[model samples]
Target: LVVLLVRLHLTGFFWGDCSLSNTLFRRSAGEFAAYLVDAETGELHGVLSYGQRAYDLDLLSTNVFGELLDLQAGELLDADVDPATLVARIGERYDDLWRALTDVEEFSVDEMWRIEQRIERLNRLGFDVDELDIVTDWDGATVRIQPKVVEAEHHARRLQGLTGLDVEESQARRLLNDLDAFAAAHGLQAEDPMIIAHRWVTDVYEPLRAMIPDPLRGIVEPAEMYHDILVHRWFLSERAGDEVDFFDAARSYVESILPARAATVSAAETSGPDELSAVSPSDDDPSFD
Candidate 1:
């Protein structure tokens, strides 16, 4: 909610009536990304002044507080939830994130590395610092820096460029890590980035994707399923005190984690590309049986 509001405010949009009821959420990787549902009370200006932003935030707090109180009165809210505390926390988080995204920083001339560090921090927060404003003191002993323009979806763009996968930001980050691991595992670190990405897609990503049986395909997204398999592999590897083969790990995932629909995938159906087929699921494997 705060992220959506901040982005709107950055773009000079004032949501006059902001509340839970006015927003819709969609899954972004494993996290929720907020979107405006009803903008009837919103106003777009050349640039919102400080007072405009403050009024919008205040209105949000007021609406949310009243709604929360109504929920509490109707016995719809959790007993432990404190409406006032939640409202205050929302404001606090908004302020903190707003500062991080827009506030200027002053540092000694010798600490120029802080500029790149700031951009890196923003990138990690899923934002791309598109423009920056930097000023130096008359004596040039100190510098002031602030981001002028910023946008989100940092990791998503990079992943899409590398592998043409249009996924949520967090999911893209997860998949990128896997892709890096794939490159390192195959000694392809020095290869052309595009070639490595294509190889990863063909040899690693697609092969694993093909193992997902048709019956279970609707249960989870491909990227999310892959992420879960990576997590499953980690746990299996930890339990076995060594790296588990990917196919074996995936077999365990299908049988133990997925629903009854997974039982239809036979050992032969789980067989993947040539690289993964070496450790193919056997007919007597518990998952297939």
Candidate 2:
């Protein structure tokens, strides 16, 4: 979340009225992919001053805390989660990340360690430094360095190259790990990558995707289905006291887990002006926000 805020701030987006309801989350390798859904009050500047960035983060933290409190009241949030502490942590982490990205450090020419350290830190945080702006003293004995441009999505590109699959960063990492496992199990590790990828698409990815019924296809993307099945496989294996075969695991997932989700994606596509809202259950109140 610290990385998300800093990266968005770097790219000139100021989400003026940030809130939990304005974001959509997708499961990703035990984490989540958070997409900004409602930008109604957002503004884009060429650059933001520290004060402006702080203001945005403050709004986000406050709104998120309130949302957490509401969920806790409804018994939806974990009992141990504290809203105030969570919000405070966000502010503290945001400050640290902001400093890392924008602070300037002066180091002597002999201290090349400083140069590599900055790049390594950003890369570890899933950012790529495209270029550096370095200024040396008149005698070239000291230097100041700054990352000119930092971009995210390192894993996404690697997965795309290997399998032509476009997925979120965390999902891509999960899938790539699976692909490697498949190659090793089948003795395809030394074979040409394209051939290995083709077999994976045919023997692994495609079969998993094809298992979804046509009526349920829109509920989740192919890559997401694959990831979920992988997770489902683990639980199924755990219960059986041994590893579950991929197809059996996938069948169990579809039978037990996919039904409740069928309406979700289709509902999102439907809420457009031309579409009618579904009838609400009689016991449910309609006026609540």
Candidate 3:
């Protein structure tokens, strides 16, 4: 909800009565994605003033607070959830997010590093700046810069460029992190990313999936399985007080964990790339099993 509101505000959208009750959520990759249900009261502007965003955030906070109260009354709220403190941070965090996305940043001519820093932060938040505008005063002592055209899929596109993996944005980010670790561990940092990516997919990812027993093949998406293995590796490493390699973690996860997990793919699925084809007996044998 916070991210949706923040992005909307960044694009000069004033969602006039946003609320928890107005959201529809779906399990996206590994996170819940929310959609705005009621847009009849919304307004779009070329640009929203500070007071406008602040007013919208205030309304959002109130709606969230009211919803939390209802949830608490019905015993649907978590024990650790505090409605008051959570609502209080809404405005402050939105302001910070708004600034990070659309705010114009100025730096002295010598401090060119700030430009890359700003871009890195935006990329980390899953934004791609298609156009950047830089202006310098007559004195030429400093530069004023702003991201003009921003879009999502910053990490997804990069991963696609290297590995041709079309995955959800969060999944791409997780996979890229693992790919970097794999490259560094294998002393392939100096090699081309495409070359290293091919090796990583063939040597690391495919092999991991191949290790899954036929019964558990439909438990989860292959990329999601690899993502969990990376997470599981971290947990196993922490408990053992040493870094656990992928092989050790994957072996333990398959034997001790994967079989116990409920399959995400429905049993109704009839055909998939991994399913075996029916074998027909040759003319030499009339019987076919």
State the lDDT of candidate 3 residue by residue for 137-160, as single tens digits. 789999999998777768889989
TM-score for every candidate vs. truth? 0.78, 0.76, 0.77
Rank all candidate structures by their TM-score, best first, as comma-separated numbers.
Answer: 1, 3, 2
Model 3 pairs in collision: none
Instruction: Count steric clashes of candidate 1.
Output: 0
Query: What TM-score does prediction 3 earn?
Result: 0.77
Where does candidate 2 have its weakest 10-residue lDDT segment? 280-289
RMSD of each: 9.3, 6.5, 10.7
**TM-score computed on alpha carbons, candidate 2:** 0.76
* 10 residues in a row with least lDDT, candidate 1: 259-268
For model 1, the superposed segments whose C-alpha errors exceed 4 Å read: 65-84, 215-219, 238-242, 260-289
Computed on alpha carbons, the lDDT of every model, listed in order, comes to 0.82, 0.78, 0.78
